[model samples]
Target: MDKEITIYDIAKGVGFSPTTVSRALNDHPAVNKKTKQRIYDIAAQMGYRSNLFASNLRRQHTNTIGVIVPILNSNFQSSVMAGMEKVANEAGYNLIISQSLGTMEKEIANAKTMYNSRVDGLLVSLSHDSESIEHFEPFFKKGIPVIFYDRVAEHKQSTSIVIDNVQAAYKATTHLIEQGCRNIVHITGNLKINVYTDRLKGFKYALVDNDLPYKKASVIATDLTEEAGIKAAEQILKMDPRPDGIFVANDFCAVNCMKALKQAGIAIPDDIAVVGFNNDPITRVVEPNLTTIDYPGYEMGEVAARNLTNYLDALSDVNITNTVTLRSDLIVRESSLKKKLKK
Candidate 1:
């Protein structure tokens, strides 16, 4: 194995002292532009990569933000990560990203790792089973900025950036009602999550507002995976009075559920209309494009990162009790349009 290149190598190669080499590498104002460029060119030629961990220890700033997401494999999360990387890169900060696989235990372990790494700030979207902000208490005690987005909790010391889940779900449910759907099924994930709970509230509220009976049995809480979607569809088929509409928590499950229903001799819209959340790309690829909530996942990520970085830079103050709610609206598509589109 080749020896790891260090500043000493660049310093010797460029005939400069270690102090001068360090200042130039760090872009210190004391270093002349010409000298700095020369050092940079020499450093590149010598294959020297600065020890960021040691540098961070001296400055007490990592210039790195830590991000903990529930899962990395979803279209929504992918878009969110893109937005975060864009803003973080533009701000001269790097991100250390980790995933929790939707489990609270893994999320707790991830939190511990981030804390030990001393990330300048943290952005987290809680796991499905995460009941409280206890795991993030260390960050709070240290006065480190922590921002939650998408699936968030009500912590007195952290801000949450999210779309109004209740309103978005209500809109989706109302659209189904307008489509003449009286009996509807609500498919969702763990209700322990704020997003799912709020959506459940909206679903119940919409039913009651429309003078429709809200039955607890109508709500199916599952993992919201493709397989779970199929199982939910099979369960729906066994119901005493078949539901005319379904408002699933996410597009992945909704699309799969729609497919299962269609296979079971159910005609979408003509029989059971369906609506989903996150307006994922698969929603469009489905035979009848899925009607869903257009969640601004990328924008949510951008806002979360910008807010955290601003706080870290002392350019803005975050109100822990405050929430940055982005715009989210229902996108009507063929799958949920039981009524004829008026010309």
Candidate 2:
């Protein structure tokens, strides 16, 4: 294996001391501009790579942020990560991302890895069935800043950036009710998550406001996966009087459910209307384009990352732990358009 080149190698070749080479590499103003350029040119010629670990040890700041998410394939989470990466990169910081695969054990392990890696901060979206956030206690104890986005947990020191799921869900359900859908069914993920639980509350509240009966069977809680959509369809189809409308927690599940319903010879909008959340790209691509909520996921990520960066840069001391609710809106489409079309 080829040996890694160091500053000393560059220093020897450039006729400068290691200290001068090191300072030049770090862009210290003490080194003359021409001398610094000479050292940099020689370092590049010698294939020198900066050691972030040693640099972090010297500055007591890792220049690395750790991010833990349930899964990496989801469109929403990927957009969030993209936004985070853009902000972190602009700030001269690196991001170390890991997936929990929606398992608490994996999440715990990831947390420990981040801590051991000496990350300056952490950003987490908790896993399903993660009852407690005990894994993050080490970060809290070590004075590391932890920020939560999307799937957040209740923690005093950490901050959360999310939309008002209750309000968004309420708007979606109410829109369906306005379109004359009384027997509305809500398909969602585990109610253990604040997002799902809040959406459930919103669904009920919308029903109550419209004088519609709120039935436990009306709210079907699942993992909100593609298979879960088919299962939800089966459950709804089994009901004596099938639901006239459905409000799904996410666009992917909603689109899949629509496919299942279509396969069952159900006419969308004419027979049953549907509304989905997140406004994912697939929503628009699918036939009878899904009506959804325009969730600002990337914006949420940018705001969360920027908030932490500001705090780290000594630019601000604003409290971020308090709920930071971003704007979300109902996007009406063919799936939920029930009004008579004027020809």
Candidate 3:
């Protein structure tokens, strides 16, 4: 293997002191622009890479933010991550991302790893089963800022970024009601998570507002997977009086459920209407299009990242801002539009 180039080698080759070379490499204000450019040129030519480990030791900051998310395969999560990366990179900070795979144990392990890595800040979207935020006590003790987004928790000292899940869900359910769906079923993920629970609340509230009976049997709790959606459709088919509407907590699951219902000879928006959360691309591609809530994952990610970096740069205080709720709205489509639109 070739020898790794060092700042010392760049200093020797450029005829500058190691201190001067180091300052120039770091873009220290004391170093003139010409000196910095010359040092950069020599370092690039010599294949010299700045040692982040050593630099972090000197500065007592990793300049890296750790992000823990539930899953990575979904479009919503991918968009969020993209937004986070753009802001973090522009702010001269790197991101260390990990997935919990929707388990508390994995989430705890990821939190421990982030703590040990000494990340300057942390951004987390809690797992489906994370019962407590005790794992983050180390970061709290060290005064390292932690911001939670999406599936967030209640931490008096930390900030949470979320959408009004209850309100979004209310709008979806109310739209179904307006379309003449009285027997509505809500397919949701585990109610243990705030997102699912809040959505459930909205579903019930909409039922009450419409003077419809809220049936506990109508609320089906699943893992919100495609397979679960199929199973939910099967269950819906077997109901004594078939549900006229379904409000799924996720787009992927809702699309699968729609497919399942179609295969079972059920007509969408005619026999049973469907609505989903997260305006994923699949919603548009699906047959008859899907009615969904536009959960702004990308904007949420940008806001979360900006909030963390602002605190790190001493431009804002997390304590002053408890929760940042982003805007969300309903996008009505063929799947939920049973009533004729008046021209």
Candidate 4:
């Protein structure tokens, strides 16, 4: 086996002190640019790969950020993770990502793992059953930064990144109403989650503003799964006066609901218009091109990661900014356009 190269080897080869070699490799500002470059050149020639574990231990920093999300399979979450990976890689930071499977117990377990790993910082999107922020206390007590994105919760010591769910949901519901939908149904996830609850508030506000009655039955809270969408469609069909439109919180669920409705002899838009959030690709492929909110998942991830890294580097303080809200816009499509276009 080839012998592992160390900073001492590079120092000897470059005729410099081992400390200087270490500083140069770590890109410390104290190291002169020219000397750092020379050290890197020599280190490469010597096959001197960094001992990140030992380096991190000495600095009390892992050079690693931990990411905890509800799930990893969804298109929106995947896009967010991709964005995070891009930013982390460019910044020379590694990421340890974990999924909670939408359960609080798993989320707590993931948090414990991250704490034990000695990550420099953490980025989290709360799980469906995550009711308390106490799971992150260890990070807080240790002064480690924690940033929340998407499905987030309020924590006095942490920063949160999110899109305007209330405004987006309002716009979606309002659009449906403008398209001649009087009795529109809202399909969403658990109300305990801030995203779903905020959207529900927006949906109700839109109804109240338009002088329409907010029927409790019109709001269907489900797991926002594909199967839930089909069940929601079935329930809607059984209503005394069928819903003329649907505003589903997730594009996946909305698309599935639309498919089920179509199978039940319903003509989309003409019979029941639909609007969804996240603007997943399925929205475009579905017949009638489902109208949706273009959620900035990737952008949100990038911003969250950049902010956390900046804080970790002591470049800025994230606590001053409690919340960072990104932009979201509705994309009009045939799925929810009930008004006929003028020829």
Candidate 5:
């Protein structure tokens, strides 16, 4: 086994005190830039790594932020995390990320782990079944900021950054109607969270605006996964009068449904036009490019992390506001354009 290097080894090699090496490695502003550079160079030459836990304990700060998401493999969530890491890294903060697997049990366990790890702050997009947020009480008691993004929860004082899901869904539905789809089906996620519930409301409002009757059967609430998409497609196919249009909550799911519908011999844009959300890369890759709502996952993450950092540094306040809504755009494509022209 190779021998591990320490601050002592760097100090000995550079002829500087271990205290100076430690302070320099920590980027203490009091340490002159020249001294800090020399210490860093020596440390690199000696292959020395600072003991992060020991340093954090001494400084009374972990310099680490915890992030919990439903899944890490998701394109949307990954983009959000990428944005968060970029901002947090630039601010000299480390990110400790975990997945909830879309379950409340896993989310609770992750919250506990983050709490026990002594994370300086937390950012969470709640799980599909996360009804109660009691697990986050410890962070609140400790004055550690907890911000929610995307799949958010309603807290009296905590900050949440998200786009207006209701309006986005309304736009998607209204677009379908404009393209000549009256009997539209709305496929969405579990309505326990605000994102899905608000979108459902928007879908209803769009129908009501055009004087189309809002029927309970028109709304198909599910987990919004690929499997759920297949199931929705199956259900739509079996309907007495098949839906003229479909508005899905996620692009991935929408793409999956498109595949399933095609397998069932249903022609997309001709038989049933579709619109999806999140504007994921798959939307463009799918045949007959999908119309979607551009949910700025990366931007949301950057803004959330920056705001939390500002609050932690006492440079900004979040208590005065409860929610910060970002802008979302509707991107039209062949998938939702139902008008047929003479060829």
Candidate 6:
């Protein structure tokens, strides 16, 4: 059997001491970037495996972070995970990821399991129906850093990383209005979630600002799943004097809804201009590419992971109330253009 490679092997191969190799592998900023790159390359080539778990035991830390999200099968969530993994790897931390499948009961169970497993910190995106952070109270009691992203919640003990959901939604709705839409329908996620609730606020704010009637019947709330999008489309189709525009809470749902609308012979941006949130890849693939807000999921994940790791390492202090809100903007596309542009 091949010998398990260590920092010593990498050190020798890269002409650096084991301490230097170790520091480089851990991404200590003191190490010059060029040297760190060289050491990392050599370590990979020598098949050196980090003694992460053993070192964690010595330091009284699990050297692992638990990440819980609403579900695993979302383009935005997947991007967030990718960014988190990139940061975690560089920091020499392992991630224990679990999905609650959009249920609060499952989220509570996952939280319990993470607590028992002794994760040093946690990153979370709340499930659709999660109203409180009680399930994560144990982590707060233990002084474990917990960071929330996307579907975040308000808590005095934890920091949150998110985008300006209300402004983003307002921007989307206003753009649709600018393109000559009056009767706009909003298809959103469960109101229990922060992201959806904020978007709903933005939608109403936009309508009131434009002197348009704020109709409670115009808002359709659901699980934000593809199936839910199709169902929302049905509800819209049934409306008296069908809506001339739509502002969906997410791209995945928005794309599916658009497909359903198209199947029903609705001409996009003509019969009904539409705007969505989260610039997922599917936004561009749909027949008339979806107009959406660039929610910065990956950047939000990176910020959350980086903050948690920094706090764990004592490299930075995080004030729980002063949350990090990333930038978001609308990207106009053919789907929301009701008026033809001058050629």
Q: What is the RMSD of candidate 1?
A: 10.3
Candidate 6 C-alpha lDDT tens digits along 171-267: 9999988998999999988787888889999999999999999999999988778899899999999999999999999888899899999999999
Q: Which residue pairs overlap in candidate 5's backbone? A: none
Top candidate (lDDT): 3
Provide the lDDT at 67 for model 3: 97
Q: Pairing residues by index, what is the TM-score of model 1?
A: 0.82
Superposed Cα deviation of residue 83, candidate 6 (Å): 0.5
What's each prediction's clash count?
A: 0, 0, 0, 0, 0, 0
Q: Which regions of candidate 4 deviate over 4 angstroms?
A: 1-59, 318-321, 341-343
The collision pairs in model 4 are none
Weakest ten-residue segment in model 1 by summed lDDT: 50-59
User: Candidate 6, overall lDDT?
Assistant: 0.87
Candidate 6 wrong stretches, greater than 4 Å: 1-59, 341-343
Error of 2 at 118 (Å): 0.9
lDDT of 1 by residue, 1-343 (tens): 8998887888889999998988777655568999999998888777665533333443378898999999998899989999999999999899999999988888987887676667889999999888777989978887888999999888888899988899999999999999999999999999889999999999999999999999999999999999999999999999989999999999999999999999999999889999999989899999899999999989988999999888888888646557999999899999988777432
- RMSD to the true structure for each prediction, in A, is 10.3, 10.6, 10.6, 11.1, 10.5, 12.2
lDDT value for candidate 3? 0.90
Q: Backbone clash tally for model 6? A: 0
Give candidate 2 misplaced runs (Cα > 4 Å): 1-59, 341-343
Of 1 and 6, which scores higher on TM-score? 1
Q: In order, what lDDT does every prediction score?
A: 0.89, 0.87, 0.90, 0.90, 0.87, 0.87
User: Model 5 off-target regions past 4 Å?
Assistant: 1-59, 318-321, 340-343
lDDT of 1 at 47: 69
